[model samples]
Structure formats: C-alpha cells, structure tokens
Target chain A: MKKTHYSELWCSSPRFWGGLTFLAFIILLGLGATYYMEHQGHWVTGMSNQVVWGLPHVFAIFMIVAASGALNVASIGSVFGGPMYKPLGRFSALLAIGLLAGGLMVLVLDLGRPDRLVVAMTTFNLKSIFTWNILLYTGFFVIVGLYIWTMIDRKVNKYYQVTGYLAFFWRLVLTTGTGSIFGFLVAREAYDAAILAPMFIIMSFSFGLAFFIITLISAYWWAGRTLGELRLAKLKHLLGVFVGAVLYFSMVYHLTNLYITQHHGVERFILLDGGVYSLMFWLGHVLIGSIIPLFLIYSPAFASSRFAIGAASVLVLMGGFLQLYVIVIGGQAFPMNMFPGKEVVTSEFLDGVVASYIPTTAEGLLGIAGIAVAMTMVAVGSRMLKVLPENLEDPKDLEHA
Target chain B: MSNKDDRPDMKRREFIGKTVLAAGAASVAPGVLLTVAKAGGESRGVSSDVRYGLLIDTNKCADDCTACVDACNRENGIDLVERPKGQSDDDWNAQRPQWIRKVQLKDKQTGEITNLPMMCQHCEFPPCVDVCPTGASFKRADGIVMVDRHTCIGCRYCMMACPYKARSFIHQNVAQQLVNAPRGKGCVESCNLCVHRIDAGDMTTACQEACEKDGHQAIVFGDLKDPDSKLAKLLKTKSSRQIRADLELNTGVRYTNV
Candidate 1:
C-alpha cells in the first residue's frame, strides 16, 4: 500500500479550491436573488400564469433526487453490507445532507411567502401530494443527518443504529411518496399511472448509483489514490444494472401513456408534437438520460476505465436533470383539459389561455448558484472533517497516518 | 348474537332521527332563511326584497357575454387588464378575486357549442372543504363555498385537488382590491357566492345585475329550495343539468339544456 500524508489528503486541492470559489459566487448570486424576490414579490421572477413553476422547482427536485442517490454508500453499508463501500461512506453521508440542504434552500426561496413555509408542517393536507412531500423531506433530512453524525462519532449508542435503520426505511418511503404525488393525480392526463411511483424508485436508484460513482472517482483522483480493480468492477456492473433498469422504466412510462386513448391526448402531444417541451422530454430525458447513459455504462469495454465511468456519471446526471425537467415542465405544457384555442384555453380578456413563463436570466443564475453552493458545501465539509477514510486500501498504511 | 343485532337497531333509530332532523332542516331552511332576512330587513327599514341567484340558462348564454365579465370587474373591484390564463399554480387572483370566468366549450364532432362558466359550484359537499388541511376553505351556513384567507397557507393543494379548477391561488398582494375583501399572497380564492352582497340582503350578483340590465335575463335568480322561486320552478319543469355530474359533487349551480 502506498503511504501518503494525512494532512495532504485532507487539505483541499487546487481544483477543489477553484470549484469552491465558483460555488460560493453562485451561492451569493442565489442569496441576492432571494433578497430581490422577498422585497419585490414574484414579479421579479419570469414566472407568469402559464409556467408558474420554472427552473428553481426543476433544480430543487433534481437536487433532492441526486441527494437521495448520494446516500447509497451508507445505505449499502447498513443494508447491502459490504466493506468496499465503507471508505467513501462518510463522504456520501455528508454529500447527501449538504445537497438536501441546498435543495431545500432553492425550494424555500421559490415560494411566494417564505415566511409561511413552516405552515406546510402545521397545516398538513392529507390528500395533497405537496403536503406529504414536505413531511417526507423534513423526516428524511433529520434522520439522514443523525445517521451521518452517529457514523462519525467513535462511541455511538445503539439508538444510532436504530436511527440509521429509520433513515433507510423512511428514505424508501419518501421516494415512493414523491412518486405518488404525480401518480395519484388521476385528473392530470399526463401523469395517471401506478408505474410512476416505481419509476421514481428506479430513478432514485439510478441517480444514487451515478452519484456514488462520480464522488468515488473524484475522491480517488483528487486524493492521489486509486480503487482496486475488484471494487471498480463491482461499481461498474452495479451502474450498468441501474442504467438498464432506468431505461426499461422510462420506455414503459411513455409507451404505456401512449397506448391508452384518454392518456394519449396529452401524453402523445407532449412526447411527439407538443413543441419545445416535447423535444426536451423526448430528446433530453429519454434519449440522453436513458439510452446514451445505458449504452455507456453497460458496455463492458467502456465501463472499465475511469474516463468511461466519469463520462457515464455525467450522462446520468444530465439525464436526471432532464427527467425532472420533463416531469415538471411537460406536466404543465398541455392545456389543462387537452382542449386548445377554446375561450378557457385562451383567457379571452388576456393574451393567451396559458400564461407564458420563461425563466429569466436571474432565475437561471440563481439555479446555477444553488448548484455551486451544494458542491462547495461538500468540498468544504470533506476538507475540514476528513470525511473520506484516509487508509482504506490497507490497514497497515493507517500506521503511517 | 341476538343482543348484537338489537344493538345495531337502537343505533339505526337514533341515526334516522338525526338524519330526519337534518333533512327537515334542509327542506324548511330556505324559507327560514328568507323569513330571517325579512325580519332583518324590517328592523333596518329596508324593503323585504326577493333574494335571487343566477339560474344561468345554458341555452340562452349566447355562448359569449363578455358583458358579464366587464360588469363584474367594474362592480367587484377586479383588475380588468391583467387576466390569468392557462394551467397556472400562481394566478393574479391568488386572493381577493371578484370577476368569475365562463368558459365556452365546443363539442368536437357535432360542432355544437355551450358556455360553461368556470365558477365555484358552491357545492353541497365541496371537496375543497373536505380536503382543506387547515379548515380555511369552508362552506358557509347558507351554502356558498368560501375561503378564510387569514388561516390559508397558500400551498395551492386545493387548486390541484379541485376537479373543476374553480380555486385560484393569490400569487401577489392586491393592494387595490376593495377594502371589504382585501387579500395578500399565499391564499386560495374563489367566488364567494357574492356573499358580501348576499349578507347585505342584496340578492343579485354584479354579473347577474349587469346581465339583467342588458335586457338579457338569460340569467334567472331565485332559491333552489323555494318551490315558487324561479330556480326551483325551472328545476321542477325543465331538464336542467349540473356540470360534470359524474363527479357526484352535487353542485348548486345548474343550467338548462341549450
């Protein structure tokens, strides 16, 4: 085993520093955006009647799914039980917590009345998917944070293990709950299916695997260390399996929607001819998110190299972005009743039926800032706390540290 | 086992008595409502005028009366210029709304058209009330569906849950809204059955008043429960239908065949 200085491994590399700086700048931008919104109401944002929820909502959902996926290392350790994932388990935990915090920040700022956010918990609408989502997210955040804190502490109590189990159980439930929000909306022609919840599960699994792979690669490269062939092979194979599952689910979600006449109206319209939203849903989410990433991860020759894994991870993340974007934006693109040009379709007094909303430059900038904030938090936390295990390759090497 | 059967019988009789009381209240309630109004009107030295609700004969809707919309905006202190369109979560009338919309639907095959005014159905069993987490969206004693903005969290779940899409989310503060019905962001809003007017013993809505003034009493105003009221008489003689009856919402607003 190659011995390295503990201090050097824990310190931030130049790339890490640069990434941190960029991330901080973006967070500052997001803060500025939030301030502007609070002072001036939602008029500051480009959101109007048609596209009420835009990039912030999309990014929030994406980050939430990504953060859930980021916890896989710990999940594997507790449930799947493997020493291979142990090295990066703490890092994953930290990333998961940090990313969720960042996601919540985006969502909180997106609200028209940020002051009334706590009312979400107090006034729980049992039938509302959104109300359930708030509860699930809050529960998931608390449990995940406690689990991570316990893992770092040397003399943890038995309750910590219980806490870890609670986290795992609730995380699974939360993903299903997120899925059910869209799944239960029978009135919405676009998203009425039993498969949506399972689809979200598969998506969460795919995103989680992709997140772990990318983070693992980053830690290895930045720490001037490398993974064993066995571990890398296992990860690659697991990613391949997840990518295939995601592909199958994605195909089934749309194909099923297309098969039914009632669903065909809005589903086909959005998928085939519903204009820009259709293009993004079909090309960005399905083609790039599912097909390309599946091929990259599953191809044995491609999956073996670090470069290939990195490429696959990037593809999966991109796909995840489009996946959420399509679900949120495409869900709204179709006229509510699937009948267009009617008086209801075009507010007779107003210009159009659907109020048009495009994310402004400020909205886009704030989204980017949210991303930077998440990455910076992860980088900073890792450096200060020595989150990644220093001598995972060999215990004898730990003596040197 | 025999005692168990007798126990259910005792419970059933009590339930029947309670239901009979409720039904009797439901039947005699409209007359009582008018009598109480007459008493109040007498005390206030105002005319004991007939209380009216728009019957909205779909057949005579002209399938296009921007007149009602214009008058409602002018009378109810609604913003006429900035109209919300499409599937939006955040609408301008997120709170403090006055003008109600009437959507014209065209049959895909026969080319036959009908105007469906998209207003709060003032349902006897409003799902908005059943599903409101905070009891903010409620049905008044007289049967108008209204929301208490002060307690509303503005989550817009009621908007999503409402099958008819009658509820609107207040996205911004409407400082210029009539002081009687001032509203801020984070509330779901809808037609209050012109409750402000109704409370003041004014039977007709701003839209109905305007429509009547235009010599187009395409809108008939009366109590549904009153046998002699125009709305009740129309229901007994004519084949009137409520929108989306399949939902089993039992909406108060009914329209005759076009």
Candidate 2:
C-alpha cells in the first residue's frame, strides 16, 4: 500500500460557494420554522396530546443513528486495520461530528421549552434513559473529536488506532442509549422490548454507511479527485450486507411480536390496517430501504454504474426516514391498553381510537433542515481542514479488498 | 332456646353500635386529618406516616354527573382557560387542560357498563417519576406523584410513561392561572391530588367535596394509615381493586363495584 496524503478542499470554486449558500439558506428556513413552532406552541404543528413527538424526532433520531454509523469507515481502517480504508478516516470522523451536531440541534430546538435546556443539562434523573443519552451524546463529541485529531495530526497519528477503538465502543453504547429511549417505554405496547437496542445498532450501520457512500462520491467528484472504481465497489457490497442485516433484525422484531397474543393488537395495527404506517413499512422500509438497495448494489447490470450506487444510497436514506416515522409517530398513534378485556366506550382523551397525524409544512421544513445543518458543517470543515485525500484512483488488487 | 333468643338481640345491638361508630368517624375525618398534620403543618412538611388515598364506589358514580369534574376545574382554575384564536374547536377540545374527566367503560363479556371520573392514579412507584429526565416528576412522601413546574422542561416523556394518560401539556399560552396551580405554557401537569388544598390543611379535595355535595357520596378521602379513617374502614368493607392491578403499581386511588 502507498503512503496516503490528504489535502484541504478548494474554496474559490463557484460550485463550492453555491452549495454552501444553499445549505445556509436551508438552515435559515429551518430556524424560522422552529421559531414559529416555539412561538405558537407545539399546537402549530401536527403534534398533539396523543402524538407528542412529530416529524422532527424522526429526523433527529435518524441523523443521530446515521452519525454513529458514519464513523464505521474510520473504525474499519484504524481499529480493524483495513489499509485501503485508512485514507477515508479523517472525513469519516468529520462527517460523524457534523451529523451529530446537526441532529442534537434539532432535538433541542424542538423541545417544548428549549430555553430550559439548561435545566435538562443541570438536573439529572440518573435512572432515566434520556439523561443517560445527554451524557452519552455530549461524550461522543469529545471522544470523536479527539479521534479526528489523532487521524489529522502528524505527531499523534500513531495513536489513531487506540482512539479508533474507544470511538467504536462509545458509538455502540450511544446508539444503545438512543434505542433504549423507546425500549424502556413499558406503558406502550409498540416499545418496551430489549431487542430495540441491537436493532438500532444495525440501523446505524445501514444508514450511516449509505450516507457515507453518497457523501464520499459527491465530495471526491467535486474536488476532481481520482476515486477508485474498486473502492466504490467494495463500499457498495458492504452496504448491501448492512442492509440485509437491518432486514433480518426487523423481521425478527415482528416475528417476536407475533408470538405474543397480547401484542396482536399493536402488530395488527402496524402490519395490516395502520393506513400510512402499514404502507410505509412494506413499500418504503422493506422494498426501498432493503430489497431494492441490495439488488442495485449487487446486480450485474449496474456493476460499473455510479448512478446505481447513488440511487441505492438515496433510497436507503428515504426508506430509513420512513421507518423512523413508523417507529416514533406510528407507535404513539395506537391508544394505551388501559383495559385488557373491556372496551373504552367513550372518553374525552380520544381513548380506544387510533390517532391521526398530518404533519404541517413547518415540521417538514425543520426536518429537512436537519440534513442541511450536517451538510453545511462538513462543507465548512473541509474548506479549512485537510480531511480529504488528494487521490484515490489507485485500483488495488482484489485480494486487499 | 332461651340463650339462642338472647344472642339475636345482642348481635343486633352490636351491629348498630359499630355502624354508628363508623358513621361518626366518617363525619369527623376532616378534623382528624387536620389535627394529624397540625403539629408542624407546612413547616414539618408531609410525612410517610400518612399515606393519602381515595376510595370511589363506581356503582354509585352517576352517569350524567359532571359535578366532580366541574369542581376540579374551578378549584384548579382550569375553567379560566380559553381556546387560542385560530384554533379549531376539535383541536382545542383535545388540547384543553383536563385535571379530571368522565370516562365510560363496558365489559366485553358481560355487557355491564360503568361510569367513572378518571384522573391521576398517584401510583406508589409511578412510571412518570422513573422516566423523567430532569427529576421534575416526583412523588411526595405521602405518595402524591406530581410535576414540579419550576423544573419541568415540558419534554412530555412523563405523559408517554403514564398508563392512565393522566398528564397533559399546556399547548397554548396560559393566562389567569390560580396561585395554587401555577400553570404555564409548555409544561406538563395533571391532577396533583389537590396538593394545594392538602398543604393548606384542608381535609377534602374538590372532587370529594362535590361528590358529597351533590348527595352521591361515592367518593371518600382520608389517611390510609389511620385504620379508623372512613377511607380505610370502607376499603376493608368493600372488595375494592386498583385499575391495571396486574402492573402492581399499588395506586393510591382504588375503586369498588365496577
């Protein structure tokens, strides 16, 4: 393997300024949406008493999960000793940090009392999964930031391997904490399963790698760098495996619920008659997120086509977003099972009926802006830092891959 | 034969004595509750020695009665809340603060119907307390689970954790809040067992008082620790059960004859 050299992104180009300006515009729009929601109270959005969490959570959670997953390239190269992947480590860590910052911003801004974030930070209910996440989420920034330093600094490059190991372990636990937020909800039938922890971990891998693939291709192409065809092939195949793993976990989750007689109501709701929820699970999550991506990446017809890889990655993100929507919003729409055998004849709180949620334009804008925040971070960071490799056109032997 | 005839008279006399004694205790419960806490009052604060509770006879809960609900709203100043401008009636109805609301239920197998006013159960080991990230949802020493408005960031995780759906978020800007309730926008709240009244050394809650005023007398409020208290005595007489008893929450509120 040849010595890998990294360089800063060119900043004077018209495309760079245009892209950065577009991201800034999106971020401004998102902030405006947030201000409107906060001023009007959560009532302005589709969120209600029944559905407390809305589209913002779906966006925030997906970005956080993908953030952890984005670090996989760094983990593989540094901790697992994949020489071919070493050059990608710097940008991988940067992207991970950027995604997390953007995601956290959305999570905090969407709070009913975002100004009281200080209370959340200062006060601690050590038993609650959310408090644990606060510590884990912040801790992740420090750990990953340090790991990026090890990769970028010439004097500390020797310690990159050790830092990689720590980052790898922290991200696993961080995603676990995220999953347990839903997992520990014993009151709701849709959550409260231990399987959620591993499912989230697998989700991070699939979503993260897909995001990384798209970002890498776009970045390299913009810089006029020599991105090797073999490297793209390897990433696509790995993405396929991750997508397959996600599918397996999702199946097991549904199958486990099917065995319980009590969980039948919730299962029937999500799988059969949950309207938009059922449709998204089948068409978006299963077909688009997993199956189609697998075919596009592994198919012989699209072996040399970059568009196939890009399309597959985009589909995975869209499908993953829909999957999260089903998990967060769909889970809340189902009424609480207060009575096992008896039916709630009538109640003021909309008991015994499925909740309806039609997300407003403000909510949709805020969610998409979360992605823009991540992109802007990466764009700015790359301009000032030497995270991108100068060339990757070296098509190595298949054995190294 | 003479002894048997005398025993019947003795039994009748004893039954009347106990009934009168129980009735007397029920009437003076307010005085007992006040005296028990008066030694130190608010200065000494609530003690674990006294566990506040309520016992409701669902069979006696009138189908058309909104007395208890109306009383709670008046007491907590929930009545002052108005729907914000441009808000739909449907949305406002759903989002309005409800410390307590009437609930109707029907048994699937038996076709038996029951009407009850549902509110916070005030569980001994409340799920809301466990899930709150900021320790804002806390249980008092006397087993009253409530949200501390000062610290609550209004994340609404408590609402999700509560099985009863007892909690509500203030979606619109609040105005004309009573000093007792201290309500505001973007905060989670519920029936705090009329904690303000309890702290002020009041013996009865608004709902319990209204239930009695309207001649239903379906609700009883007293110290569960005092065996002589009306609530405890009634609990012993009736086969009362907690909602979702399988969860073993050991709720402070119990119902009978549902």
- Model 2 steric clash pairs: none
Tell me the tens digit of each residue's lDDT in model 2 across A1-401: 66677888884579999999899999999999999999988778888888888899899999999999999999999888887778898899999999998898888888888999999999999998889999999999999999989988879888877889999999999999999999988888999899999999999999999999999998988887888888888789889999999999999999999999989999999989999999999998999888899999999999999999999999999899999999899899988888778788988778778987889999888988989999899988888888998888754565765
Q: Judged by DockQ, which candidate is best?
A: 2
* Candidate No. with top lDDT: 2
RMSD of each: 12.9, 17.3
> Candidate 1's residue-wise lDDT over A171-231, tens digit each?
7787787777667654456665789888887787778778777876776677666456556
Q: Interface RMSD in Å per candidate, to 1 decimal?
A: 5.2, 1.0
lDDT of 2 at A146: 92
For every model shown, what is its TM-score relative to the native structure? 0.80, 0.92
- By summed lDDT, which 10 consecutive residues of candidate 1 chain A come out lowest? A343-352
After the best TM-score superposition of candidate 1, give how far the Cα of residue A167 lies from its true spot, in angstroms: 1.5
Prediction 2 global C-alpha lDDT: 0.89
